[model samples]
Target: MNYQAPLRDMRFVWHEMFDVTGHCQHLGLDLDRDTLDGILEEAGRFTAEVIAPLNRNSDEQGCQLLGTEVSTPDGFREAYRQYVDNGWASMTGPMAYGGQGLPQMASACVHEMLMAASLSFRIYSGLTEGAVLAVHRHGSEALRQTWLGKMVSGEWTGTMCLTEPQAGTDLALLRTRAQPQADGSYLITGNKIFISGGEQDLTDNTIHLVLARLPDAPAGVKGISLFLVPKILTDGRRNELSCGALEHKMGIKGASTCVMNFDGAQGWLVGEPNQGLSCMFTMMNDARFQVGLQGLGIAEAAFQGGLAYARERLQSRSLTGAVAPDKVADPIIVHPDVRRMLLTQKSLTEGCRMLGAYTARQLDLEHGAPDPEDRRAAMRRAALLIPIVKGFFTDVGQEVASLGVQLYGGHGYIREWGMEQLMRDSRITQLYEGTNGIQALDLVRRKLMGDGGAELHALVEELSQHVEAAGHQPRLQEMAGAVSQRLEEWRALGKTIIEACQRDPQEIGAVSVDFLAYSAYVLLAGLWLQAAVRAGETLTDGTGESAFYQAKLQTADFYWRRVLPRASAHREALLGGANCLMAMPASDFSC
Candidate 1:
């Protein structure tokens, strides 16, 4: 299947929906539309022409580990060289670090394209960028001077080494230890599993941001300290870290997920001692948002493949009549069921793009806004939406990929069609970057109930204002009202969940996933409404392509009618509470 970057919709979201250039202007960054367009076009070309073709081949060959060296798939090394030489990796990095310092909005678009082209290949640089962000934010001036420039130039890749074999999500159980030395550096000794790009050979050196406890540190998560462990030492001797083994994963085979053993590796602490979790979170949050974009990218690839197949693959005649009378039978696109599946993919993918772009813009505002109040507001908004973006986008990504498979009937199951690869690749998104369950719990326990729902309430009010402001346009007035009503419903549901959680803390976990999904659907509805309003205005003024705007309106309508109703079921489940779920005994399934 051929992959085309959704540049038009991305531009629509950036310029029309989010006004990213205006946001950049507020940051005193001279990022005009033309510059962003050029970046997108060039990135699109690279992904489509250079990176995308290697996706399947790379997956087929996978990564190979012989001795201490791990080799990426055939084309991956060359592709990484091209990616670095083009200055793509440094787009969002600091200007002082040899980066172009573009807004995250542009990086988000490029990231989506790269992920769509080859998620397995993209994982390398994706993790590197996250590591760079962390070290830049939390590392000392000397550390930054040593690592930031090399990483920003893509000369050295980085990894986040947090998950120990015994720890997983429970960071409290981590037993990794860092022993201090007289020279101020420490020796990091730990085994980190599921470490992406841990031991890849694409770069001369791999910088690992490890989490370990000091000898005199307290127990549990509080004792964890962040360390920078490099594979190669400053004097050019190899460090003690090695890839014990590569995980035989179900997907993303080309990306090396290694079990790393840091046997007293020379390292320097990042941030303060025993503050590793908070320090690592800076990287994890960036990674989580990028993972959400990965979800969006994979979903888009599946949607395009499915749509193309639906258009060309002739099947039974349409219920109404033979729409393609000249052919042997009507194309499956004529079938209502096929159309339903396709529309679901379309609405979810496009809506996710808008949400991701908006969130990326929020990230830009959080970091670059001159006003402290603006920064705080953006941070709160980002915190509120990051979990949803990571969890819901990944869940919907799997859903859309499944729909793509179903649309292909028997063909999708085969390897040649490439739909199954998308499904397999997207399946991991929900698991990593703090699993969707963790995200849901964070949403309900931390973001919502933790703050008395102030951030959420403020967001609802802001969205309400947007809806009311669009009341003048007849086409958008109804959508605005519909979305406004859903927002109130969402707000009420949050209160109900909070009240229930007060009665029984278990209620938080019980309703958390449902609440997250419901919130995500409503949030997407609001974004889709915003996009629909813009599309409608364009169509009304006869200034843009009629077909594009009409398609946007139709997808928005489908989302309201079809996708939005799923939130109602989620609400019902949320109200059901923990009784039914908890009533069953743990041992009952053993029989």
Candidate 2:
């Protein structure tokens, strides 16, 4: 099945639900509705025509390593060139650096479409943006002048080098060493593993943001510092870094995941000394949200493919009656189980799209708002939501993709169908950018308890206000009420968990996953309610296409009735406490 960008839904969320034009005005940007619409349309055309067709072929061919150079599959390089030529790589970068300076919302929509087209292909540009943001926020003037413009223009690419052979999640265990040279630069010597786009031939140079230790520094994570290590030097000599090997993986075969060996590589420090993790968080936070978008994109593609197959694939007659009487058998869509699967995918995908867009708008407000109070509030909300977006979206993404495969039955098992490929590609999103488990812990421990639940309480109040404003409308009254009720329950659950954590610290770890999932369901309910209200208003006015508005209402109802109940299961799990989970000892299983 062909991939199509969900432009109508995206436009509705941007214009109707979020008031993105108002955001543009707040930021002093000259982005009108027409321009935004045109951008979305052109982006849709580019991804569908140029990028989507390369997905399967790139996966089949993968990447080849010849000595120190890594070559992408056929069409990959040209497609990237087209992407850069179209200025997509710099869509949301700083305008002073040859970028379009668009808001995160616009960039978010474009990214969703591109990721749906090919996650492997999108990785190259996404990493570059992350690196650009880091330098823009923390790099020295000389560093910015030397590298930021080229990176923003896609003349070069970037990578985040954090992992080592001994340290995967624990940065305190890192062994990479950075020795100071006579000049301002340092000699970075260590082996970094699992670096995405680490050795690709997509750009003239690859700038690595690495974390390493100084000789006289303190022990553990405190001693680590950030550095800029280029693949090639400014003096026209190759750096000491090389691709030691490429890891063979189950998914995203087209994306090169490399083991990089930096042997006395020339580097420059970023930010203050012994504060590398803090600087890295600037990029990591952005990356977490983007990974969440990746999940939404994959889920959307899977849903479209499954829905199309269900409408076309003939099966046994409907239980009630034959919907397609002229055919040999009724379409599988007539079956209740198939409808359940399709609706589940639809509910999750649409809800995720709205949530992702909302989060993107929050990011814009956090960065662009003139008032200090507004920026702080936006920052808190963004922090509270990022983990949920990352953890729940990816978990549900895997579920949706698996259902897509199930919808195809035997055909999904074969490589020709493409469903399995999506599933494989989506699985890694949950593992990388901090594992979903780590995200859950961060949500409950760092964001929630770290701030004494103030951010979460603020979010609950905001959702309550939205529900109250829309409560009078007939079509939205039920959803509004449901959301309000869920918000109260979420607050109560938060209080209970906080009280439990005060008694036993392990309680936080035991229930974090369930708490994160529960939070996501409630949050998505509010977003869906917002979408339903806007869609209902359009229908009441009798403007635009009726079918599109109707689908919005139906999907919202499906989410409220079918998907929202999952929150109860998560609530029960969260309240189950830590005893059962900690009951088993370390060495008792084998016997």
Candidate 3:
């Protein structure tokens, strides 16, 4: 399984759609063409040669547990060593803390390649980033000094410990308790479930950023505090608690998902006593985007696999003339249906890649841009897109992976083909890191409603400008038109959902998921139009790879033609409100 990344697509997004050079100029960063090219080349090489090979082996071996210790698959420790040796783990951290200090756009490009090559293997390393960012942003100076350097270097690992068995999605019902110790430390006693990288032996120590309620704290997410509980105490060589058990899961089998027990564990507080929930949410937002990338990565891999298979696998004669008459059967590539699946995967994968990088670029603008107004606008845009980044990318991940399986027919389900693995691995991306449904609710209930929809109106209006600018390109024009139409529909549907919520607060529980899908479709469609116009420009230049640029153009067309149409029904479901959802009673769920 040799993996050649879509380098051409990445370059297109970086140079054309995202205006990376302009962004770098704005940031006072010296990222010339040669520098950017060298970075992408190195990242793609590392992903294909180093990270990808471990996927199959990791899936087969899974994680090993002995007593209180958990070890990752066969080559993980060595591979992780190489990953750290190359400074890949430090890309997003502060230069003062021994990090590479690369732009987030560069990091996003590298991440998509790494994840596409080996999502399961990358999971172990990815957790360290989000957790480190949380600590760097919110931790005390002493805490930052103690942990940031080592974690950034991958000498140690980190975990975000939220989600108890009973308190998933709803933090108000959490039961974990943190009792303060006289020594300024705390004693944590709680059970954490679905904790990724929780108790892995891939590093010297695993730091758990646990959210627990203090003994004298308030109730319902107010009292939740973030604690830095290391597997080993300060001395860093003793086990304080135990890995209760490894979760037997549906996907990303190589990454250890653990049910952990923190029984009177010695822990130091990461932030203010009662500010843990807020602190953890900062990490969650970062993790949410990364998890969305998990979907994008797996989907890219599946798309590549499907494309290769379609080119070579001879299944039937085409309805049209024989493209490969020499072969016994026509290559699957000749068939319209096969092309549909391939185009769907390619378009979505490319669009999502650009969207992810666009989001990353916005993050960079928010963080590094000189103008305060520009920073504020970029931050707002990033906030608006986060839900789509988290919800839309992951949903398409499952859809694209399933399409990969479909392309393989019966062979896809078998272990050898690896299509099923793609589907299985991507399934959890939508489930965890604040489920897609929760993401939708956040977008509509929180982000859109802010300042009485001023931000929403601004974003939609901004996207409308992009659409208007896309008038010359037919594909872009169509995508722009469709998305603009959907936005209006979404606004109307949003008002209906809001009205329903006013009547019955539980209306959210009914319509959140479908509403999320609808919102995601609109956002993705807008992104597709943006990329389509960029691709059209590249095609006009005829400078480099015309075929690749043309492919992007055609895929964008396919998205508008085939994919965005689904938004109509999804919008209808949202407009239907809680009636269909609430009309059914709990009794109807009985078997």
Please report the TM-score between candidate 3 and the true structure. Answer: 0.96
lDDT score of residue 332 within candidate 3: 93
- Runs of candidate 1 with Cα error greater than 4 angstroms are none
What is the lDDT, from 0 to 100, of the residue 1 in candidate 2?
A: 62
Least well predicted 10-residue stretch by lDDT in candidate 3: 447-456
The pairs that clash in candidate 3 are none
Off by over 4 Å in 3: 237-239, 473-483, 491-500, 503-506
Instruction: Tell me each candidate's RMSD, in Å, in order.
Output: 1.0, 1.0, 1.9
> What ranges in model 2 sit over 4 Å off?
none
Global lDDT of each candidate = 0.91, 0.91, 0.83
As a TM-score, model 2 comes out at: 0.99
lDDT per residue (tens digit) for residues 251-277 in model 2: 999999999999999999999888999
Q: How many clashes in each candidate?
A: 0, 0, 0
Model 3, C-alpha of 587: deviation from truth (Å): 2.2
lDDT of 1 by residue, 1-591 (tens): 888898888888888888877888998998788987888889888999999999999889999999978999998989999999999878778899898888787789899999999999999999999999999999999999988998988999999998987889999999888999999999998799999999998999999999999999999989999999989988999999999999998999999999999998999999999999999999999999999999999999999999999999998999988888898999899998999999999999999998898898889889889999999999999999999999999998899999999999999999999999999999999999899999999999999998888889988987787787668778777778889999999888888888889899999899999999999999989888878888888888999999999999999989998999999999998888799999989999686
Q: Which scores higher on TM-score, 1 or 3?
A: 1
The global Cα lDDT (0 to 1) of model 1 is: 0.91
Supply the global lDDT for candidate 3. Answer: 0.83
